[model samples]
Target chain A: MASPIIITPAQVATSRDGEVVMLCLSGNWQITASPPRWEQPALDRPLRRIVLQAAAIGDWDSSLALYLSAARTWSGQQGVELVEQGVPAEVGRLAALLAPKPTPPAPQPQLADLVASVGQATHQLWQETKDLAQLLGECAYSLGRFIRGQAQFRWRDCFTEMQQCGALALPIVGLISFLVGVIMAYQAAVQLRQFGADIYVADLVGLSVVREMGPMMAAIVLAGRTGAAFAATLGNMQANEEIDALETLGVSPIDFLVMPRIMALFLMMPLLALYADFLGIMGGLVVTASILDIPSSLYWIETKSIIDLSDLSTGLIKAATFGLIIGLCACLRGLQAERSAVGAGRAATAAVVTSTLLIIVSDAVFAVIFNILGW
Target chain B: MNTASGKSKFAIEVEGVECRYGERVVLTNVSFAVKPSEIFFIIGGNGCGKSTLLRHLIGLKQPVQGQVKYFGRDFTHADRAGRQELLRTFGVLYQNGALWSSMTLAENVALPLELYTQLDRRERARIVSLKLAQVGLAGLEDYYPVELSGGMKRRAGLARALALDPAIVFFDEPSAGLDPITSLKLDELIRQIRDTLGTTIVIVSHELPSIFDIADRVVMIDSGARGVIAEGEPNQLREASPDQRVREFLNRRVAAVQQQQGILHP
Candidate 1:
């Protein structure tokens, strides 16, 4: 018998449904198209070997489009054939638009995309700055309108806020100031007992309450209680978009919202400062009476002699400035709020903290200025 | 602009109104007027200057150029007192409904009356209950707006708007992000408010369904259109406009598009 004829896989030209598919020596090449009409008939003879050559003469757009159309469509369904590991440069551009580019031919991060991202970040920063600027400008303009418009309303709100900020807040203020006065008198009594100057405790309590304890306690109380409340209220308003609602209501958030708070705090702060002084003095009276055994008559006599109106007025001025800074910062931050509720909280906390900082810094500056100017 | 003084008596007027945020131009020379007691709806795509334009009418945002007027008083030019006096005639129901979280619904409704009106506390409470009843929320007076549904919050806002018995009420995107049934209820409430209150209502929305169901006149403000391309009753708008955007917007929204589509003829 004649030796059986062997037709190797390479020699075979597979026709899919009778459309001629040229196989290459590499075993990877195959003609891809939409399942073609399959007009090409059977091969002339059994193939012996395969050779590869480019049949097309022109640009590969039509070929790429054909393959991609098939690939896109087949990929849309269940894919049948092996796709190339990476698209040809021609196909890559087309694929970029139609789908996310596949991995392996990783896209180099372009200078343009990086530049675009940087530009976006810069634009965002610039927008934030512009927003902050506009917010501040609006606050000032609104305050000016309020100052001009809110004559009676400001006083009313100030009185009401004073009750809220000062009278209602008095317990905490009084308690803390009282304790501080006792501590001062006790500390003085300890040191002075050895020096045979025990009665000087009355002078210590009297002087401290008149000067530092009054203003310092008042500032501390407002910072903790009133300042925080201001921040929280403003912050909540900011969060709730109530400020935006005010704007839409044609209510100048600054004028209608901020001005009342600012003016309220302004008027209230001095009254609060005075109340704090009275309570502080009362605290000192208790300490002087109990520890120093100095009578109220003597304590008041000494306090009146040393504590002039300027000392009181200086503290009052400082409290007013402190109130203004706290209310202004809180309201400004409130209006600067974004959508989230946390922003309002941050704004409120910031108001309290910022006011406390201002209270210190401004107090020192005012002290120097008043000393220099003889106010 | 001309009709603001003439026989037409524009209830609301915007003339050459320009608004911007930093460098980005939000609106450019948008000018239009709503007639007295008219149900005017301003419709546009997102970020297409709908809410911004609505804000200008109430003096929330001061326009960069020209003016927004109500009853011939320039809203932007007016001082706070002037604005407040002007504001007395209109109520704004903001996008969030702007109910105070700290206050209950009764307190929220009673606030404007407390601040602006001479109504006694008991009287204000009665009025608040009455307004809440009018919005189908009579029993929910004690609950906060926070506890209410989106639809309920809107209704509560409407009640608050009616607190001072204003002549006009402005709604900002009333149906946005709401379920269909809730949106439909709101649409009915809005129409009822107009028909019963006899109040001019201006709603800024792109929600096509609610806009057509209630708008006595729809003001279509596409960016490409010079300003407002179509203005008339909801049905008349579809027939009057040759613009494709207007037709697509109107025809689909309205039920009788069969005639417009020539479906009936064929």
Candidate 2:
């Protein structure tokens, strides 16, 4: 077996000989190592010529060609003639091959360009907002047609989506709501014990979970899970030209794809929220019974006494609104996605983020409206 | 570049190769040697595993049973570093151009140079422009792949593939979605590359014009036979081959052109 050859780092040194610059290259010029930067030799006289001597160079690759090209460029800039002496024929040929061609200069940024770009971005955002509004209006129109038995999507697909966003989501929703219940009850127990009002832990856990946490947590979970899925599915369809095929076949994607998803969330979200409320209360009962020594029957009675129909209805209404927001954001982002794999990924991320934001904002709006209504 | 044993006359050598997907065998006992600077074509009808064979040659997929040698070194059994060394000499142009959608044409072409060379930014840009110009895509460096038409995109892809001046260039269906004139121009470019630079070219295509215009030798794989059924110069094979399938595959375009001319004259 042959021993491996040791590679010396590439080096370039220069000397001034009369009006000519003597450039000597040594060592290996392989791509694995960085090449030394070329600097013009300092001379007091006007340089008439640059001579490249590469006889000492070991094994070489494209890095050598690049270095030689740099020397050629420097010679051009200094208006000096470059003469190759003993440079490998292949490297010399490569250096000549990369001879600088005239190309458009990189655009310089200016105040006008900045202002134009800003205006362009604003115009694009406005266009996007208008498109989203149009999509929502079309979705509403599709729903109306669906209710009238005239829409195009299969009932089986809608049921599948419902199962995806509803029944399939129960385990995660139950887990989150139950943890919320336990934490809320434990915190309330800490405060109420100071006032000798430990029984109120049940009221606090029940009322809060029913009115806010149950629906809000459930909606946020669905936004991350179902909304992202919807966006990814439709975005990939759009990327694959499947959506275009549907349009060509006289089927509106909004009717076939978006409406079914929206309908599934609409009917399933409130039911999920109600289920979450029960799980959360059960968690509260367990915490109170263990820590406060309250009987399960006593905790249940206190929870029933504090919670009313208006509170349950308010949570259900907010859950329904959140479902709508999630469905709209996801479908809008999917339909707006560009025809590429990266675009589909961006759509999924945007769906989760947008739907989650809208859910919180609408929940606050619901709080304000409910406060005014005194329900 | 000579191997440790000695220089191999062939640029690429495939011996006793078998290709399969799970249980389905696609090609078996496929053996061929591509000489240095030869324009080699792998031609077959639809679903004959032409691309599968190309994949094996490029090391995209390993053959179930065979040795693929590049320059006398075993490529299929080469370790990661060994394979990387062999791959550096390869330039592949996929059917759809496969230009990175996020990058401009200049960036697409410059990526290989950036990764493999220590050239400064300015020199890199110069090489990029030179390559783009070589492929007739000069001055459109700022344009994205989506902004260009099909022919321009393919040209941009060619520019990128030639970025490193690879010794071997593999093209997958170079003429697939192109108009006749554009496809012919691409064929001319392939011929020019081989004639001028002496780069070995391996192409997987069913395009008759491309095969006839540029291929120095051709290998036809048959789906039914599950291996290469014919190997020779395409024109000679069309005229003189005993295999009916090879003759039919190669002469179909000629027959069509003659029929068209006859109809016009009549």
Candidate 3:
């Protein structure tokens, strides 16, 4: 059906007349088998040129070209010239098409490079901070305008975002908070049991759940969930030029895109935090009745005595702060994302990381402020 | 306008095809056939279903009312593996290049090669370099798609599309985002690919310069009619198209060039 190809190893024979090395190739060099190893031969005399003799070669493709290129590279390294006069014209053209270009040398660094890089990073940070502050100021202004019935954002969009951030987050927040409560009660019970002070476990779990773990856990979950969603949605819109289109049509991106999401997270955070606190305290009650053999009424009385209106208010305050952090971080990262498809994924990851960091840092600050005020 | 006579010599045949996107009908009663190794162009204004037709032809979408035969084989109903075998015989370059954002240019080119061919890594890399160099993008193997310019990105996309050396290559607006000089260079590169490799080319473009320069035969789609209104060589259509709209679309470029020269000299 097809022409059969003859085979042999490549043999380089040297002639004394012109000091040329002729490589005689005979085979089916059609990329089916391994190529012949043409080792660089040691020459006593000055090598003038290396030429390929392919008169006995059969059908071929890139295999012959790769072999020729390797031979050329070897000859060039040995300071000998490779002449393509005897090879087929098609193989020559294929070899020439794939001839590798020499790469440019890398630039040398100087002392000014370090100074310029630091200066550039500092300027970028300052510019970004300024832009973020401007966005926040505009959002606040829009909020004020809305209070006076002048803002252009839709109330329906705000309600929709609120619904997503609030209702959708309940199950996850409930699961994680209940687990955290169980862990705290279990750990505290082992130590408190040695002192015959099992009732104090109720105080520990209830006070911490209401004051710290409730708000922090809810904030972190929302940071990973709603905040990331916000970044990806807005980043995709930016990449598709929809944000630009909105601006072209006399709609402010801040008013149309950012405000609704920010309002939703900001207003929904306290409610979600309160619900987490209830689930966490219930988890403590479950562990108390099952593990510590404490009466349910006694545990409830101890929890009620330990938690006051100030403790509840402190957790809500942290929840509200964490919500602002998540909302702002998501919006900032998304709006500043590169206008590309890949940038949307990066924006979502950055939003989650930054929101978690800001939430924790601000929660610590709230703890210190509330401690100093003795709340 | 159906120009093909029979299916024996045609590499691709589309007959009585109708395509819709949801409730809106985009194209209807479209029939054409491309001879083997010819550079064919599909040209139209925006929203004229040039891309929709391409999707149907490439087996990505099924037409509502007709059949697409590839080499006399029914393509509209080919199963998964059958369609994959069919796809191995052709390549497509989408709008925005659509090179994977994660991989480097070399890896992107090597993707289809790795999937379809039995070439080893060393040979695959060599072929990658050759294809990139073919598109005038030598020594840019390690660069990511995001780092490249629009023209370089398009060239990288072309390199990836040509990785498998398919019999036919489809390009969706290859010169859409390029400058005039870069667009001309792209037109020349497309011609070189067709002539050098003898690969059949089907291009969809709205740009007049590219349509006239590289197209051996052109099909004009109009959204108002929801079908192909004219088919011929671009120059033939410019001179002898019976439809006024076809003449206007082709003649507008001549008018723009003449007006530019007038503004420069007078």
TM-score of each: 0.66, 0.57, 0.57
State how far residue A214 of model 2 sits from its true place (Å): 0.7
Best by lDDT: 2
Best by TM-score: 1
Please report the TM-score between candidate 2 and the true structure.
Answer: 0.57
With a 3 Å backbone cut-off (N, CA, C), the pairs that clash in candidate 3 are: none
DockQ rank, highest first? 1, 3, 2
Best by DockQ: 1
lDDT of 1 by residue, A281-308 (tens): 7776787787767788887787777778
Docking class of 2: incorrect
Shift in Å, residue A149, candidate 2: 2.8
Classified by CAPRI criteria, candidate 3 counts as incorrect
Model 2 misses residue B264 by how many Å?
Answer: 42
* After superposition, candidate 1 runs with Cα above 4 Å error: A1-160, A171-205, A238-241, A244-313, A369-375, B1-7, B72-82, B102-104, B111-126, B139-143, B223-266
TM-score of 3: 0.57
- In candidate 2, the residue pairs with backbone N, CA or C atoms under 3 Å apart (3 or more residues apart, or in different chains) clash, namely none
lDDT of 2 by residue, A215-332 (tens): 9989999999999989988887777545643342234678878988988999999999999999999989999899889999999999999999999999999899889989999999
Candidate 1 vs candidate 2, DockQ winner: 1
